[model samples]
Target: MKRICILVIVLYVSMTLCGCFGPGISDYRYDLATGYQLICSSAHEIKVVPKSSVGIPMIPAKVVEIVFDDTFILAKQLGLKKESENSTYMIPDEKVIRYWIINAKENKIYGPFENDEFNKKQKELKISDSLKLKDVDSYKKSK
Candidate 1:
């Protein structure tokens, strides 16, 4: 009995040390109904409907990844290792008629919407509180 108890304690310690469980977990990448490929806190449950929302800028509604940090000064200093001279080309900011991701951060989305975080064409919508939002995953799978 003594040997068995010691062995169990050792095993438990080993398992704990090996991260059998703890708060050192981070899920920074997961897909969402909006198709944004969210890299947000999975601990927070995303709602089928957002109470309020914001807009995306630059790129088209469905397009991902817009805007390049083409610092002209950096290019001039480093002589641009292999970047194209026109690669950093930027257009003047216009009306918020589109939505796009801001580089690899992914969640920094921007788009035109009257009230929700997602767009109808980009995601399924359900009528609620005078607005619409992406359908929940469970709800979407059934259809």
Candidate 2:
């Protein structure tokens, strides 16, 4: 009995020291219509859904990064439709227009905004450089 207990304790300590008992860190990339984003987190995985298709069953593309970063969010807002969807005629639903970003520290979202206003805000934030889209194809193919 004593030997068995010792063995179990040793195994537990080894596993804990090796980080087997803790959530492991992961790196993710997101692909958006405008560009790609990269995220590092310990969460199981990131999820992305088209703003138009929320709550509806759809195969979400394996996106790499969060879309709520300055550039991608602005792009989404600029693309929002003016009309609403009706049962008889499917007008694009403006309510579904949104962009979101999630990470260990922040869960930020951006809703629709006018083009000129959004541009001005981005410039003021000094995040315009971060908005430039990366070579998504290289990352996608490397994966």
In terms of TM-score, the best-performing candidate is: 2
Score residue 96 of candidate 2 by CA lDDT.
Answer: 44
Residue 41, model 2: Cα distance from true site in angstroms: 25
Residues 26-129 of candidate 2 have per-residue lDDT tens digits of: 44444433323332223322334343534422112222222234233323311223344543422334444333232211223432334455556566655545
| Per-residue lDDT of model 1, residues 57-143, tens digit only | 122212212212211000000011213556653232333333322322232433333223433423442213222222122222210
Q: Assess each prediction's global lDDT (C-alpha) against the native.
A: 0.30, 0.38
RMSD of each: 16.6, 13.7
TM-score of each: 0.27, 0.29
